[model samples]
Target chain A: MSSCEFESLEKCLESHLPEAELTEVKHILFGKETKKLDLPSCALEAASERDFELKGYRFEAVQEQLRQPRRIRVGLIQHRIVLPTDAPILDQINAMHTRVGEIVEVAAMCGVNVVCFQETWTMPFAFCTREKEPWTEFAESAEEGNTTRFCQELAKKYNMVVVSPILEREELHGTLWNTAVVISNSGNVLGKSRKTHIPRIGDFNESTYYMEGNTGHTVFQTQFGKIAVNICYGRHHPLNWFMYSMNGAEIIFNPSATVGALSEPMWPIEARNAAIANHCFTCAINRVGTEHFKSEFTSGDGKKAHHDFGHFYGSSYVAAPDGSRTPGLSRTRDGLLVVEMDLNLNRQISDKWSFKMTGRYAEYAEELTKAVRHDFKPNIMKE
Target chain B: MSSCEFESLEKCLESHLPEAELTEVKHILFGKETKKLDLPSCALEAASERDFELKGYRFEAVQEQLRQPRRIRVGLIQHRIVLPTDAPILDQINAMHTRVGEIVEVAAMCGVNVVCFQETWTMPFAFCTREKEPWTEFAESAEEGNTTRFCQELAKKYNMVVVSPILEREELHGTLWNTAVVISNSGNVLGKSRKTHIPRIGDFNESTYYMEGNTGHTVFQTQFGKIAVNICYGRHHPLNWFMYSMNGAEIIFNPSATVGALSEPMWPIEARNAAIANHCFTCAINRVGTEHFKSEFTSGDGKKAHHDFGHFYGSSYVAAPDGSRTPGLSRTRDGLLVVEMDLNLNRQISDKWSFKMTGRYAEYAEELTKAVRHDFKPNIMKE
Candidate 1:
């Protein structure tokens, strides 16, 4: 296969190959062991043929004779938009649908019970440009949008839950929101979670397009497991991750589209820290490649006008409640990271750590309530 | 100097030697640049002679020229107790004071405005045995304990703010609390912050010794900077870190004594995540050496009873608000980490990320208030 000059052939081959063909990779987080899973030959071959990347890993819970282990396979897909930003909206959407379809088929072969796509996967990340004409055209209904309909079909076909992050246009009011629409395996729309936090940093003037989400931290209980979505910039807020876990989410997905220049170093840390702090599995996915816009835009930060956002480093990975995490996808490739997790590990870790028992939420609730008041005084000691 | 059979000579020599003798280490977090600082020859020579590890790094804000640079050097000392667990309380305390004094002299030579030691630095970690006789004997008054008095003297001598974590015996009630006393440069006790969260994991039955902290998140405003302490296990809770930042702490110290078998991986990620989330500086210090007690103890797990807690794993490091951090001290050595920070960078990063603006704390405050209620229903959106 012909590769981009920017892509490393060695990394491409490693993700495309079956685990058996690769060298052994052992992972230990706080002493919990993680093992890699070799994908089926059919899935590997499909990935090779389609020129997309696929890898799998497994996390297990200690065997308890009293209860059966609850195992679930989750897939996180990170990809670039198939077409250019200047392409016709429908054409770009359709091309993305087709590309994602091929990858979803491989996930089905790998027996992934749930799958998630990168943030606003069907469109070029045009929020940086701040022009509302063509970009707003990309927004659609959260319930009945074309992307949701497509994901519903894929979910039913594969018997897998699907989380699709898209720019949603409130049908009656014409309001735009960054939303993740969840579809169950039975092909029904479960619910939608909007991005709770909006970014105003660098070229990401996301507030210009959408306001903060009104829907609170929503954990969806599906056929496979309990899950929630913390979209993009919401990962920076620790309480955003905390509320979802408090809502009984077993797996929280952070589907983000952050660039390397802006947030790559943080990519590996935040979600993993969330998993450790909250006693739940966290999946962090970022988009790959750069998207050049039709017109030059200035970030207002004294830099020369540029046409493209910095590289959207795709290092999608999964972190377990025990702090063990799967190796991420290539920074320069479109890849699917499939992780098989024993859901019981969440309870096992919680039982072991007792974070919930020890977390002084009520104390902080009172503190925060007071802090928001005008007459509140912080406990600052000065000698 | 003769080294332990387990430690590498190369690793030992690196920390003992000055920055000029070692390779350069550059840190970048979310695009912020961090530079290493060279220590004075006198301090380097003292480190080599006294044989304790020392290293320094610096973080800077963009040259705004609007305000003078708020440059401050903070030091974190992670050390092993000089005397064994079986040693007399007074003797052990005296020996610890002497060893830490030598380290503080080096820190003073490096121009550290503030310095903190590991959890209960004056005593061997004896909570694992759940013994009260000799261990409770180590507990002293929070306001005028022996450890606090020694720290006050050092603080006055170096004109440095001192944070000393100790087992505090409340005078009125005679209750024991794990606390950190903050001493001002003028040798006055500013205040004390206690370990808000107690661990019950593995060998840490800290509840057997002390209850949760009564002091709210206390930020001590000294002459150099505003600082706070999150003693040991409190680092696992993100809100604990958030509360300190909310109280206007520019730098937070996590004086910890965690073992490798249970928390090596989390050691690096948690404090760094707190810095990124809180838009502040965090110095995480963990004690070196495995302290063997005279008596064996069982963790109630299926494992055999043991005498020592697993390796303390000293890899102490400092993290900046922008996510950059210095190289940590060796895992098997007692060391002091000195980080030169631009306190203005805290405001710079907060302004840049806009985390505080978008945090939506009032929303979570309401959510947490509801969550602590008896009849509260979580926002679980299940089909």
Candidate 2:
């Protein structure tokens, strides 16, 4: 078989003991009483037939007489590219559209009001191969992009807000950017926010394709709630998450495409820490499986040249404001994690933690201003 | 038995299944091949006789041809108050000094170049009581206080740097503050940095005693390495950690005294996350056992009044820049964790992660300057 058609799923998706052990351990952030929600047989059958994984969980706050619960169902979908990496761009996009459509249909059946897909869901994570020829061909307009149009259709059909992370090609400046388009439940494009941080380390030659985003931290006010997106590398910056929370975001989505070798250890940490720090619901979604590139690439480290970006290791999960979280999905399979969260918990945790009241932002502002100056010297107490 | 004299270790130290289960689970941040270090038998005997826990772990980095490894042994001590809350102030101070002296001796024997004690190590955590009589009497001069003098002697004896967090009574203004005094290996006081953030919620009536710290982020450049102290509530603020890192801290110590009901879940997360973000080694030290006050107090929550401040769970551990960590000490017992870390690993991981190169500090400085304004508006996009 040709390299494009040669599926080395076994070699790429090797399950080490640590990963299995981590999967079995229940984090203290999750409650002991947390149980799985029963889904319809048709949804289960769809996942079973397509060989994808489906997980559902519910988080409840203590009953309060002060406010009615603002419960919403959030759906996070992490999936593999439908076709081989060497396929035609349009054909690959179409195949991915079909795969995501099936998952969103299952989410709709489960009463999801808001759904989000992995980073650049319509294309394979080809940034590792850094060749600008066919990879840049995948960039399209954010407003009229084929991916956004498809997501808008699904959003209106299910009356769900869809957050679609994509590679955007600006027509005027001829510049490309990593962006997330937020389509409201009415199928109107609410807004788009680009990835705040572009990673340059490892096999992630993302800077070769796009630079830092220009659009500031934006919270999309939807029928479901105030949501924001911290696409991919933005997850590494706590300030990115803090700025969104400061903007009144109740839920933040982190659509990421990271391999297991470079980021698996940090996968469960950054987003969950953000949820705790910001007092908001955070959904972390990553694409599954490995995609072999047509050309070999080197990661700059003194290692053998390779054709793949290592395994994506999809283990998407949801973390709550109180630090509680749902168990993650499969590390080796495409999966959908449906989380039922009470928005009241956000305020409850905020009141309990009171990090906002005592944050001392003014002091940090003054310090940061001084720190950014050209003549800046660190506050190091030396001998 | 009187509540003050009663050491209900069995009842207050009860280990639920989840806590035990969490203890058993080896976090993915720690390497699988990490093994225990062989310490002098006298130190082990001291711990065995005193019934406190002692754990030692070593972390190594890949040998580089360019530079010799900068290896340093760090000791973190977490212990219960040596006497009853109602005991005379000087007597209690002496008792705590004796207890910590024993631990420091053991640490010195283990070749610990730098050793740190838990927050307010010389006194009971009496902020919950909010009674200003004997509790406030524990406050002393950060420079010449008995606690500082004691720690200075220890530093001189072992030729080790000592970090002692204490409640300070500033002589000039007669104002009190929570401070960490850094003592040089030569038994001289280098400097002091106060707690950046003061918590107002929960049973902590700390504001009634002391306000926020005035000293900026201070990194003490010792004979061993540059270190900073992010005392207690400062752990919750990511900016505090960032500033310390920006000041070029190699190791940041978070000496905290917090109870289980309000903060047990967050204990393992904040410092570890800071270590990952800042590319430094973080040593988290929390005191053990429950301290019952002489008088009852009510946390602003609508619960009944209580005489104790819940259990101060002691799960002290060390987190490296690469996200690998050592197993934490026991939750129920007084403990010391000695970590042998190669300081060169900090630069190596920083080179690998490249967060500093990509971090847009100037952009954030401008954003924060605007954010702290009176008429500042969050960059929120609405419908």
Candidate 3:
């Protein structure tokens, strides 16, 4: 066939070649006949180069290249505390300072730009079975408390963001607040967020000890990244994570003081979901070990004594934006977990997946937040 | 008092009471001298009522009750395919007597189980990309073909199980296999799940013509309690919605086709992580979407294509042990997804707070898997 005619015929075949015919054409073209086809010098040269072609059409190539530089190293200190409820309150506070300082030092050595400790890290879990004495002494002033100053100095020394949870002492009413403090690398106290939702279920009698946090969901701008904290029990509320992320928190930390029996299994899935849904990185640090205490007061459920000396199984971890987890640290041992991460990976995965971009957030907010009457039901079939 | 007795009294006061003052106790007890001292009687009565006293002599009551039971619903289905890849061969074989009949008539209605359809429910997805002419003919058997028979029958008769993806044969080898059949209660296929992960990174060149599935990860089991399907590509890797239980999932269906991402995503997380990590019901069905096309093919990546299509995303689901869905009909759409479930609030929320059972598995398995390797030097920590 003439060259021009051959080109037209090749295009025609390319457009309509059946599966069986394409196989035959491939056999014939790549067979001995490939040598016999006479060609224009330029066309022959081009054909000799390596490019994938079928009939006369070449396939297009697509490549995804990284656009930004994003790197971050994260460390989680999964601490275990067996607070002696009967032990003197001052002793308990001193023990926390010593133990937490050791972990902070270790995290600093690991080159972590930020280190997170579990909720209420400085006190024993006093909410499960509220005791009046523990509550009275456990509450500490946020600005001038010994724990806050100690952590601030550590942050200054290590040049890392230090997140510590304590029983925050409210000035006006003398009540306590379950609070998390985010300290900057320069020893400046960036901000503090109090626990919003107080749980009254199971042994979690939080309301008796502290009122809900007054500050709304807030994200702090830090040198490393915009960060936020969602204390224990707050993780269940999706809106909490959403609000913080929408305000531009690149990394959200959930530092919790909980045992394996109450929430360990949910750990692997929940934090990761938050990261994926919010398009942010998540670090969940949990306390391991058990605490035994005696209840000082009687309650409606009529529990005189509470002993959570059960294992605290510390499975601390970091969830990437794409829902993959870095290798989780141990729940058995008292140790430090460090992970090197790229801050850009969150943007890259979000750009490709487009969950938030494509999500119908406005509509959901309007529809979901409205009060559903007793008789209301969603019509799934309505197109 | 004697010196020995005085010293013993001093030690007792120092050890038992740290912050309490003797004056406060004496003032509180002085007025009760007129009343009879009945300490033993009070102690007996308190003990009988399950009340225990703390070190400070504060009375507290304890309630001992058996843990609540936890239950979840699950569903499963298995069906067959009728259309072979070769058209003339199919012409010789009557479609009425094929396996599709048993799926629509028996499996959909009488068996009425969690109706799982065979992979590539309509026409096979493997034909068009391969260089085979006769196989192209099989592509014409989609909507008006045997699939309609199953869809209509199950939609009307047994609307229990949610039917999975049903292939739709459009034209000659122009059919699409990565499709889902979501049948609602009124006997209509509500939506579809197009395969998202199209295997292109390996020997399987699934990108020749049929594009990758475009649907995002979504949950369908709504008030029916949350449930979702991670089709072939959806199963390849873990993503946000793949194993996420927003409220919670009674069942998760992973209908897969391939063995690796060329079918890998299909086999790995489809059954294992989708179930264990998520703590939901899960089922993995492989079509057994396998095909033997008589065509040699060139992959988009310049490799010789052997067998074009591996297997199909089969119909399988993982569900909570309880056969109950959150809240919906247990009817079959096309490929059945029937599950009998108890939707009691107690059963849904009765599990221990922290998936303790699930955490134990990760702990024991961590040694065997060695998922996190610590071989790399500390790049960021070095001065």
Best by lDDT: 1
Ranking by DockQ: 1, 2, 3
lDDT of 1: 0.85
Instruction: Give one digit per residue, the lDDT tens place, for model 2 in B345-376.
Output: 89898888877767787888788778778788
Q: How are the candidates ranked when ordered by TM-score, highest leading?
A: 1, 2, 3
Ranking by lDDT: 1, 2, 3
Instruction: Residues A1-383, candidate 1: write the lDDT tens digits.
Output: 21122343224334443443222112112235568798999999999999888889999899878878999999999998898888889999999999999999999999999999999888999888989888999998989888999999999999999999999999798799999999999999999999999987867879999989999988999988899999999999999999999998999999999875447657777999999999999999989988898799998789999998777778788998887777778778899999999999999999999888799889999999988776878889987
Per-prediction TM-score to the true structure, in the order listed: 0.94, 0.92, 0.60
User: What TM-score does chain B of candidate 1 reach?
Assistant: 0.92
In candidate 3, which residue ranges exceed 4 Å CA deviation? A1-68, A173-175, A211-216, A237-243, A276-279, A296-306, A369-377, A380-383, B1-74, B78-120, B123-146, B154-164, B167-317, B321-340, B345-383
In candidate 1 the C-alpha lDDT for residue A374 amounts to 67
What candidate 2 gets wrong by more than 4 Å, as runs, is A1-35, A63-66, B1-35
DockQ of each model vs. true complex: 0.46, 0.36, 0.02
User: For candidate 1, lDDT tens digit of each residue in B1-383?
Assistant: 11122342224334433342222111112224456699999998998898888888888887677898889999999888899888888999999999999999999999999999999888998998888988988999989887888888999999999999999999899799999999999999999998999997766779999999999998998888889999889999999999999989999999999875457667778999999999999999999888999989897788999898777878788888887777678767788888998899898989999898899989998998998887878787667
| lDDT of model 1 at position B231 | 89
| DockQ: the better of candidates 2 and 3 | 2
